[model samples]
Target: MARAGLTAKYRPQTFGEIIGQDFIKKILSRASQQDSPASAYLFSGTRGVGKTTTARIMAKAINCLNGPGLEPCNQCSSCQQITRGVFPDVMEIDGASHTGVDNVRRLREDAVYVPMSGRYKVIIIDEAHMLSTAAFNALLKTLEEPPRHCVFIMATTAPEKFPATVVSRCQHYVFKMVGLEELTAHLQQVLEKEGLEYDSEAVRLVAARGAGSVRDSMSILGQVMALGGDRLDSGSVREVLGLAGHEVYSAFFQSILDRDLVEIHKGISLVLEQGLDIGFFLQEFASCWRNLFLISQCGQAAREILDLPLEEFEFWLEMSGKMPAPRIHAGWQMVIEEQKNILRSHEPSLSLELLFFNLAYLPDLLPVEQVQIKSSESKKTSVQAGRAEKKSPAPARKLKDQPKKTSGPENRESVPAKDLDWAGFIEFCRKSPDADESLIRMLGNCTGRKQDQTLVLICGQDFIFDSIQKNGRRKIISRLAEEYFGPGLRVEFVSNGSKSNSAFRDEAMNHPVVQKIIKDFDARVLEIKKVQDRPGFPGNE
Candidate 1:
């Protein structure tokens, strides 16, 4: 009298009708055709990947009166009985309801009987993972020594819950989730069969929302069709499913690009008011950032990866030009890392608001490349100013005694001792093949000063000071310092909060590179320390 739901009405009757899992279908079909079916089969996968459906088909294929064949001939009375779930030889048990040992004992007792009219008696257990441990133990003996005329098919979403003993007695077949393209094509075919007019994007949205579950997609499509009538569009799908549309994401990205906190707040308020699914919204937001990043980096070639509609691809491509790659990359990272926190927070809406505000202000902190460029530009300006201020050429005075050479290869040129400072040392370290990039980056946070013949490096953090003081790192620093400032020049590290004058701290903070680092990292000077050279250190001695 009433039409069946799409999932039941269009359920696959044969292996060829199933949408995915080509390999498993081939193996099972061959086994059925050859009449060598396993005594027990364990089908496991996520819901709606057709585990239970496949089990029913296997029963029909085995019991078909025509012959033991690769596919069930639905024309036969045995196949029709199994299809209608009225077959006397086929028993479908719900594992959730029959979880006790007593139920399992009854099943074992009944399994001993031979088929009344078919070649074998088929017992299908759905949600087998829900069975109790005792029940599994009870079923173990029957599964291990099943009757020659009986077949046991157990389907479960979570196979991990089954005992190893029970699993070892059966042939396990793992079902894979349906791919996005396959799922979309299936939904389109279903709509065509129903004679419903639908947009391609609407069908895709339903499939994406299903997330590899055919039953879930069918259910969603049914609901959308009920409200959407015969015509299904992307707008109706988004409205019915409580999903934000492309325009919402586009406006949000524009707010981020314009650095407008007010517009961002408005966009968030609209999303909350629309009652959009927060988890799915975050997922889509992350996808948008990913698309922007790819488009920014790969340009037109990104279309191949994105696989979006021409209009949508062009929109993102234009937006990508407005945002820098580094900013897009940073935004992508922030959204991905904060998704869990936002969903877990007591006030998810508030957490989401904070996230958008953070993205809006991301430009205030310049990217690493921009910071390095500004630092280099300042250094060049300072060098040019010094050159312009020089009145005459200074005479080079010959040294009475040549500096002692350190042991190394003949081609290794000695570093000049004049004008050796922290900035110059950092530049030299960048060029040196022996210097570790991590150590060089760590040294970027330190300020240096000359205390007579010793160079004292001031660290704002205790961890940095401790890290530089390790024997291996200490030796490397000492060797580099010796090469730069000449041999026998002692180097000492002072941690934060050490005694130092305000004048020295002020000068250190004002240094070009230090100023750039402070701006880029949003760091403040905790305390500047002046180190007193010790007399008994390795180089000091």
Candidate 2:
């Protein structure tokens, strides 16, 4: 009943003693009773979910001084030595510090020696993904044919980074985050043993904050109780933790569903004033959306979706119906994107605000029925047409045409395409809004091939150049021609070009870098800007 640490007070003594991890307990229990135990094991999961704790328990179970059984008797020397982590044979090394080949070479030299006090020497390595390539190669050799009196236990939070060879040679066990109910029940036992009184809601709040780690839950309880006096209330938990209130999150979400940016902005400002980490706030919002989506999809039984208190679960169940599936799914994606931006951006608040306004304009982007209007000018002409039902009452006679504004062919001047400035032409193309980085590259590579007075664009690659035109690049070309030349002229492209453009400029203008450059200059590129006359000047609008 007395101990120096809290983990020691609750550390499981046997397979059956471990709570919230019954599945892992069963596998280890059977292996302790088997004729041959595996040489190496890989435990992959989030931290504080009993990976290292279970490894110590399994080591004691196999090497107990008494009879070898599924559970180790703590009275035995093997159990006591392992429980305190003082055993010479069972060494626990931190992979983060000892990841070099030289350190692993020393391990290889010691691995050959026989166990002095136990049946087999067990090595538990934490954070195995941090191991160097050479260290992994050395371990891979040992895993191929392990020593007769040796066993290896590797634990990591990121198994995807581990080498395939090291993973292939070991039996892997993935540890899941403990559920809410199990964590709450376990915390209740802890509170009662410590002689502290807590309501079910208070217990649930501590469990939820633990975020799936029992160790963290106990740590949180210790922090809450350190305030003194034993009356644990919901307000006290909320005040001490300073988390964004559940109602705040719920209300912000309702505002999003209703497309009310004003309500959402007010809620965001309130949370920011509390000095909360914006990244964590975004993560919490995403998590809340995820739970609501699950509740909406799963109906009543969704109560078991996570470890919320009954009151909190009821709140989500009631609120889930107001949000539609498409909206929820899009919100989930937007939240994830916003979280990423929060990490990479310097202005987290501005990013969060932009993310909310972006949600208001979603239905516009979704595909809908297509309406055809030939052009802006053509749309204007159609609008000017009179009512059709009132016309054509008598014989269908045609009206006389009006006089033409210009005698075009006599006065028109040809550019001749021979003296065209390649650099100047590319600068004009850069002004086109329809031209993205790739299309700009294509234009830069064009050669001025003229058939008499006509300028034909000769692009080096057919496939790359054609993507712009087939994908409706005419807006860009028309804009370019109007700016650099005049109306009634067109640009045509051919597959191969006779010259090359500098790749350096193209490489520098990739979309992300271009955005940074625009921000740095605080100026729009000339090509994308409209050329208009001054209001008071002659020939001006």
Candidate 3:
């Protein structure tokens, strides 16, 4: 006896045997049982959804000697011949191989002959979209008005490729993908009938990997059975499918929620050791966060929305409850951003590691409500400390009695602004024996005043303050002040918001390089922020 594959051995022979296509089954059954069937039929759907199978079953149903009915009697010679592909009255043609006009012309000529053995001659054309335009044109008249004893059935994954005239002449039925639950149940039944020891998780995984195709699921099951022997488990299925275990995702997500950088690093290392594709891992990680987001919102209601098994849904629900929605949402966004970068990167593993580190610190960055609450609490603490300082009189009195002078500089009000000329100081800096041009240009936007021993220079722009705050620039300014004024004169730079700052920012934005960046990225300059003395600006003092 010849060994038949699972897909062939389990091929549906009757409408009742076909799973997950009740509409197609119902339509075909009604037509097959009728006294007068449609002369032409069109079946359209994705691969492995039983378009060709339904067409063959219809052929058998029509030709079966028992009766022209919905069910075919395999015991009948006509049905057996059709099943074995040797029926004289039934012809199964491959549209791809016979795409020429001459091939269709021969088919047209053959259509004229009456059924030799069966009541009706059935012609099933698979992949009908592959038929050439000339061939379809040649068969139009014959297809529209075939002999009384002939029935034509055409199946195609892409029906739109068929000419409008061809489609209009036939009764069309559209097939849909099988649902996950339906596929899983069918796979479980198949395994049980085969007397294989299989876990439910293994069947579920195979069903998911099939992506709503029973034939595809069966094909995967064959490979899994070959590798897993008689007993099947979720771990073996995961290994075969190159899928990360649920625990890996849980650990990675927990690290992100705790903002544990070390744990995140270890988790990434473990993932690499598993030899998982970084891009696929990141995609799955993003999906996990999305599932968490859904669970956190709807609770138990998320089970239906997620379409996952009960235990998997419960796992996600428990993880989601530990973190707030906004935190998960933020992590989801980071994973999304890094996924794009990872695709374009040459070193995906390194990119993935960096992404993990970035996600670990996401809570500390911005937009997380916890960080905002902490900031508000710190402000309250500062206010309370100020009130406490006010309640103590001894510290205030001691400070009042102490001298207000310091060795560096003094903050005295009894001074004139004109006494310390900023322009003259810049000119002096320019003529100095060891002068710096950048330092001199920065001093142009500043005005100074003599406050006791200190020369207080107020800068119009934050950039000017940054330039002067640098160690080299500050030493140069102090040296110039001492040389131009007195030996004890000290220089102090302060940033004060001014209209000139906006003008400078606009001028910088209009520069050629910045304009090119804006044009290339379609970007806009939002604002020119003032640089604070303590934190300052990036890439500056």
Candidate 4:
């Protein structure tokens, strides 16, 4: 017979059918096959990781007439009835609903009795954490030594609430949030079985919004299917689910970079017109914005840092360059502030709108560092201004600070340098693979003194040099060495060495070019990291 709900119809009948709990599956399957399954199992994890499902499966397998085995023979009457929740010997209780002393009393009374119809009596209590103190005290005796044929299975999202007495008596099985790839696969199966038409993007979006809960995903998918009737396209998925479209977010990011609030509002309006969730839009937009910031900030390859399809990867890759890191990081702070404050206001749209303007001219807005930079830059500008240059009062000192460089070597030593001119080395680097100055400066962290024929640069981490080697760009660094440093000027990257003061300090930020980059990008120094070019990984000669 067809199960009533989607969860029922999609429930795992066999061990392999269960999703996102491989570790639990192995233990349960082995124990069941040996006919030595643990009497009491403490199923703990985040919601919808199949704690209850495993309990029910264990119940069915143990009472199975043909054999209490790993794989239940669904054809058997005992297995079939248990699967349908009609088995005479099995009782599934919700601790949240029946959490009083009376409930435990009733269970205590029922325990001594033998199995009425099947070989074993199984009680599966869900949300077991909610049972009252009296209920737990009352449950102690029976749980310690129940009838030979009786077994107890408890499931909870909050395992911490249960008394130490209760946990000591049972085997503990933890459920975890399902991995994205695993959840995505499970969703595809559901869609295929339901005859739902969806693309990879739609699938990924659903899985992400699901947030690692199998039941949650199924429920959301169910609601979405109800809204769309049958076929779930990405557009309908976004619409019904009130999800902001990726393109909409892309446009919003572009607007922010270009400081075009008109385009930003237009994008926001498109999402709102599509009946998007206003609060959710801000949340997802913020997240999407944050990811772009990370990618831009890190110069992380799309393929290396993110797991996305070609279209999606390309979208981020294109935006990553335009936004840059510091700007994105700065924008991220503004968005967060807007979100925190918006919760109190009655008009979320207006709050976000004002926020848009705030972030728009934010580059012009003074950060804490701008005062010092202003004092210095003003002196330089006034001296330059004396030579017949006409400008509108130097744009009102919109940029704060002299960038990192204005702080001088002492102030800037705390940050990475921006535009350090490495003489012919810089011009030479611009033509090579690691030409991006931002990247080149980060590479400087690995710089070391020449040891004989080779320049032994110790990378703080192997992954940095490993990454360069993988991109086949190591040759570029080698070529630059040959051009500037000389022939056989080997660039030997090693790991497992201590970091340098210049690398960790913002000395580079003191450079004139570094100051310009800070002003141009309108970014602030947050944190810096150094990677060692160690041996073995992307190993060297």
Candidate 5:
């Protein structure tokens, strides 16, 4: 027979063999030592964190023939049978496959019988959250008042799926993911026992890839060892796992710092060509920015928090010195904010390329305070230029009918109402504090012309015409128009159909307010319908 895989072959058979979850181990061990196991237990956590493994170990601890103790002796028949999964009194059920009221009823019938070869009949259910609502209901009474000889242990990756009624009847223990340091130590022990020579960095990479799951780490180690033979290195692990190396990230960052688009494009293309996992690649890229931010802000003290290799730490320290702390912080925030978008995009390659482009130009993006200062300086210069122009003589060749110019809002009142066209009216509304933003946006999709005392607004779409025709909105528009174009001015919306439906759609879509709403809400325009005036409905006069 083929040898069992590393995860199964090296499975922890005793509480001492488990790597993490110190609190859980203590409680379960004490319970077994006193022969007072709870009638039902709920073990919940992420996969590969030893929920099922702990449940099995608890079974053996309870069934050991030597005595009810803190740990099971592997030599006894009962312990050996439980370990081999053959003990008549110790049953392991797959909750996913046995998720029905009928199956639960059968289990209830079996629970009443006395143990054939052990002190208590242990029923261990793996993935217990998969059980149907009816199945859970059927087992509720059994859990609340189980037979003296019965013990139920449920292990699930998602305990939130379990009903509160079921959870309340059991001893709930949450298993935590194994810490990086502890997981690394565990892998080192496994490698030592296998007599394999491995680089410490390689081991750490494997542990990090596992992401706090002991079994996952062991599985990754197994795959690495199979291809790497008797020795292991970081390069081999990176290649095998399709992970980008430190050099790639360093070169990428260098391109960003230099603002070299060609080099940035080449680096991203190389990553895509190598078929690296984009999610993990982005994760590592984000980590680099985080490291830069930390190093720049905290100086050498960041080394302890980073826990990076000596060479890697120095490289980041050097890179951090070249970039300002604010830029580093901005880059970090940008990466974090856009990571989900990049991952969810249909064209992740293009999204990633755009992100790199933004990073390359990060220095050019000024802070809010600096922009405000520059704006104020520009206004002062313009004011001085205006004063200089006023002191100079007017051009002799000026047209007789040329309109006079105004410099600011204070001079706006000097301009004649007849000279205020549609564009001028819109600009005035924008500067007016009383104008409603929604009304301003609706007005943008309209073409206005003055005929006698009436100002007719030719709406590009039916919706715009309908919206402005409302009594409340029309009154506000009329009031604003009268204020801008002089008193007694009237406002009316007309759907002249001068533009085609497609033209109207395009104009509506291109409007600044419409575009802003679409981008801000991630929305799309489904359809635009024209509203026909109903009989007796208020019409534009």
Candidate 6:
């Protein structure tokens, strides 16, 4: 005979039958064994972890024909009726549907009556958090002081949603998620009893997909068993769940670790070609990185943290050794920071590609220690060069002895403005406290020459010239020139011709957008050229 569905077939009838949550079992067992059981109980945990089931078991344990005991005799009429959900004394109410005060009021009225055929009247409310505020207040009086014959048990996935007053009136029991090992063992038992042929790999996959929900795991296992004929394997499980195998994530992590762009491209393409959800793939990949991180930090103990099959765990352990903690952290951080953009993007495939592109280049970023060492080396080199200059005094003496020669652009200098290195002067302005970044940038891009005693500034474009000439900038520039080149020096401004497209190219390179592109793409603007004659084609001319 085909076995009944595992969930219903193996539903725990007694505390002993429950798979996980030993602590809850102990509490309930002790309470039932007591002569005066708590009137109200609050059971809180994630879904499918036996919250509601425990409520029913509690109901039976108290009213068992064998008398109040830790174990319910299922053969007893009260136990059988409660199990069938047709018992008169045992009432199961769904808080989601009866959220109004009227529903609670009706329940309150009904709860006053004594047990019809059993020793105690049991009222169980599922999803108790869904009760409206008014409903909870209505139930409070009945919950706090129900008749001696009645008991109230409330089961909810979220205890936090309940008001403090409501929670304070009841004894609370917290249920924990079923462990992966326990869940896997449970599935194995079910498959064996059903006489189904199965691979351990398939069982592991179903357990993971269950995510601590026994009901969900049974559902997944049932589906896989039904579709996979008599035999279940990892391939069937992955196909049914529409999930990429561990190999895919392994390939991705390896590619990123190796900084191999080509391999990364191939891996991502393979993922896309398989029609996996990009968002889900990213989340899974991040989980893999997290696993690797744990492994690197925790060593062999990482097995406890990562609930993967032995093969997958071994692979992760191997990978964990290959990638250092910092690089893994950096990579994982990038994935996390970009998650919002990737999900909101219209083209997730392209986004994934770009994300991997960045991951592939992570090795190019220097670690802090390396950067500090390089900086120290550069400083040492500069110091050595300075000492070498000091050791060679002959050139300096010979230069000082030579007559100061003046040739082209002579009159511009008291220090000829031409002889004044414009680049050096711009650097000085950059270091100056009074000169802001904008002014320094503007000066850096400008070409300077001498016209009599005036320093004539030729800007690359009209816009640059206009910007600098705003406010009292002309006066500021003149004052700066006088300070640098002496009392008679003055400043004049002019713009390059509009037809000169190369106009301001040097200064324009400093624009924020251009700078961002250079920084993000590791690129630069080598040359800026414009057509000298717009009216004629270059080739024909």
What CA root-mean-square deviation does each model show from the true structure?
13.9, 16.7, 18.3, 10.7, 16.2, 18.9
> Candidate 2, which segments miss by more than 4 Å at Cα?
1-5, 253-263, 277-280, 287-325, 360-541
> After superposition on all CA atoms, how large is the RMSD of candidate 2?
16.7
Show model 3 residue runs off by greater than 4 Å: 1-4, 258-287, 303-315, 326-541
Preferred candidate (TM-score higher): 3 or 5? 5
List clash counts for every candidate, in order.
Answer: 0, 2, 0, 24, 0, 3
Q: What's model 5's overall lDDT? A: 0.79
Every model's TM-score: 0.68, 0.62, 0.63, 0.67, 0.69, 0.64
lDDT of 2 at 433: 62
Worst 10 residues of 5 by lDDT: 391-400
**Clashes in model 1: which pairs?**
none
Sorted by TM-score, highest first, which candidate order results? 5, 1, 4, 6, 3, 2
Worst 10 residues of 6 by lDDT: 392-401
Per-residue lDDT for 323 in model 3?
Answer: 60
lDDT of 2 by residue, 310-365 (tens): 77788887766554444555667778866886768888778888887766544333
What are the per-residue Cα lDDT tens digits for candidate 1 across 176-261? 99998999999999889888898999999999999899988988888888784768899999999999988899899888877788
Our model 4 lands, by Cα RMSD against the true structure, at 10.7
What TM-score does structure 3 among the candidates reach?
Answer: 0.63
Could you give candidate 6's per-residue lDDT for residues 1-541 as a string of tens digits? 3333768888889998898999889888888878467889999999999999999998888889996788898999999999999999999999899899999988888888888988888889999899999889888888888888888999999999999998999999899999888999999998888888889888987897898999999988887776748688889987877678888888887777667888888887887787776665676778877887787667688787776788888898888656545456667878887888988999877898898887766544321111111355674674465545542111111111112345654334444444355554565565667776556655644567655577777764454576576546678777777766556877778775354444345545654545654665475453232322223222113
Cα error, candidate 1, residue 497 (Å): 31
The alpha-carbon lDDT assigned to residue 193 of candidate 6 equals: 82
The lowest-lDDT stretch of 10 consecutive residues in candidate 2 is: 390-399
Model 2 residue 321 CA deviation in Å: 6.5
Candidate 5 regions exceeding 4 Å error are 1-4, 364-541
